[model samples]
Target: MAPSLREGVSQARSFEFLRLGRQAPWLVLGLGLLLGPGAFPHRARAAPASGADPAALLEQGREAYEMLECPKAVASFRKVLAHPKATPAQRVEAYVGQAWCQVVEGNEALARETLQKALEIRPDYPVSPDLSPKLAAVLEAAQRDFRARAKVEIDLDVTARGAPPELGMRVRDPAGQVNEVLVRYRTDGEWREVAAHSEGASLWTARLEGAAAGTLPLYVETKNRYGFVSGREGTAESPVAVRVEPAAVSAALAPPAATGAASGTALTPLAWTAAGLAVATVGAGTFFGLKAKEEEARFNGDPSQFGSHDEALAVGRSAQRNATTATVLFVSAGVLAATSGLLFVVDGSHGPAGDAVEPGFAAAAMPLHGGGLFALAGRF
Candidate 1:
């Protein structure tokens, strides 16, 4: 016969009572008291879910959440919420945890949406209340930390002939922790960064807004996490002066400079003139040297062997005249070549010239002058 439900329950309770009574001392010892078959509680058993290690799994999910592992954290939290025994509070916490992970992963819009769902689960959730203050603190810290990187760019205008000017920077700070960096004007003082950041060997960039042209004073202040503020002052910064003159001013300046050049031109006719003089001097000197050699050859022979005394004297006089003329022409050529070279160097410094004087002219003239001098000495 089938057992009645009441009788079955009564038998079960009686067996439990008998087991407990015998194991009173063992119960006190807290061992082996519930080992007997009749001591088992009657409850429906459920199959273990796949891959479930609830405690360790939940802890892993929380760690991923803190590390901003959005997808993994969301998956884990979803798993926890699917558990049959998950309370309303636990479900709400899971939603909020997923939302925080999203925020850290830069999905602000999704984070807000997830947070709305969390709020729906508990109409007055602490997540929203707690998040506001923390988010505000982060933004404030970013702003304050970014302030130390303020920098100004300078631009200058000056006359073309004016002295090359340097840029100067002045920073004023009431506190002394921040320091100023000295920078030279690069490419007309273009926009540049004033600070750098490091993230575990990775470099991060800070944003720099546009800088206005002209002289400006900038201040930089830095603070530690504990709110100790210090500032530094830098030297004043000025733009390189760029000179822009009216057409009239440029025209007026042109004529006087041209007149000066005209007068200078009279001093140096043409490179060919100097070259011709040098060639003529060399030729004259060569002629004298040859004549001298001939005279010496004649003198070395018997005294009465070749020419009349008058003929020899006339040859000697001609050689001396050629030598003297060669000396004068060679000296003049050297002076002219030197003057031309100096003018060319000066013109090169100013700007592009219509005609560039070659250094070869001076080089050629030097050798010619030396040849002429040597020929003159030979004549003596």
Candidate 2:
């Protein structure tokens, strides 16, 4: 068979490459250099269809968000996240973008979940309020939710202590059961958790037995208590250095503030009454909601549980009605509790005698998301 024109061109290119590689090694080296990693830096990268770098993908997401294309922006950010070598900062930015997408989709709970992942990477990470005032407003609500469920703060009474260290820790833990242990590095560079005795009060005491005069990492684990069971690990930013002479310990009569309530203010009598009603109403709503959901789940659970198809349908409709009532009650209670902040706005706490109101208190209802915090510096 006769060779085609394509084959002839391929053979010609191959012959030229071979002639250069053998007869002129320097030219071959030059050619290899020109065709190496740097020459096709962006070619055949992951997330091929995007045709943009991670930074560009992030920008595309931002522009899409501004244009109100929530799904497109989310997809772009997801592509950025899918990059195998994504940095923590890049991951955080992608998460924030994804969170904004959730907010746009009217899923505050999911949005809050997304932001929590970002905060896990950089604990004190803040969100920029000005980027999108509405979304930033959602972030404020999300942070409150985070603080309620999983905030972790550990305060030590002394960092430099004696041979046997008694580390007094005042933990503002929203996640359940704040567990701590002193971890020391062995001569072979392996960390072993040292046995420690602990006492609980407003301040929980963690006393390390026979711990030498050296630096040790104070490792803490936080667990989810109420809804789900999960955990995360955190380290003391500053390591503990046990010293020859223990540092002077200070004592105070006042008790430490509780987790998620450090900035609380005592309520007035009228405010107290309104707050009680709000709490009561929401509590009732939750009870009914859970009971109704249980019924719905059973109806959907197994076929044999039902006596008849019509009976199953009737049960389903009943559960639906119950759920509808729960929704109405939850909304009503949320409205009442949400507007309760207005009462605090005039709680006899004046700010600079005529400036803007700082409202010495902060509260958020699920829908309002009005009163938390936002920071541009929180951006990676």
Name the top TM-score candidate.
2
Per-residue lDDT of candidate 1, residues 206-245 (tens digit):
2222322333233222332223232222322533332333
Clashes of 1: 19
Error of 1 at 317 (Å): 99
For every model shown, the clashing-pair count is 19, 0
RMSD each, Å: 26.1, 23.6
> Among all windows of ten consecutive residues in candidate 1, which has the lowest summed lDDT?
361-370
Candidate 1 regions with alpha-carbon error over 4 angstroms: 1-57, 127-380
What TM-score, to 2 decimals, does candidate 1 have?
0.21
Lowest summed lDDT across 10 adjacent residues in model 2 is found at 361-370
**lDDT of every model, 2 decimals:** 0.44, 0.58
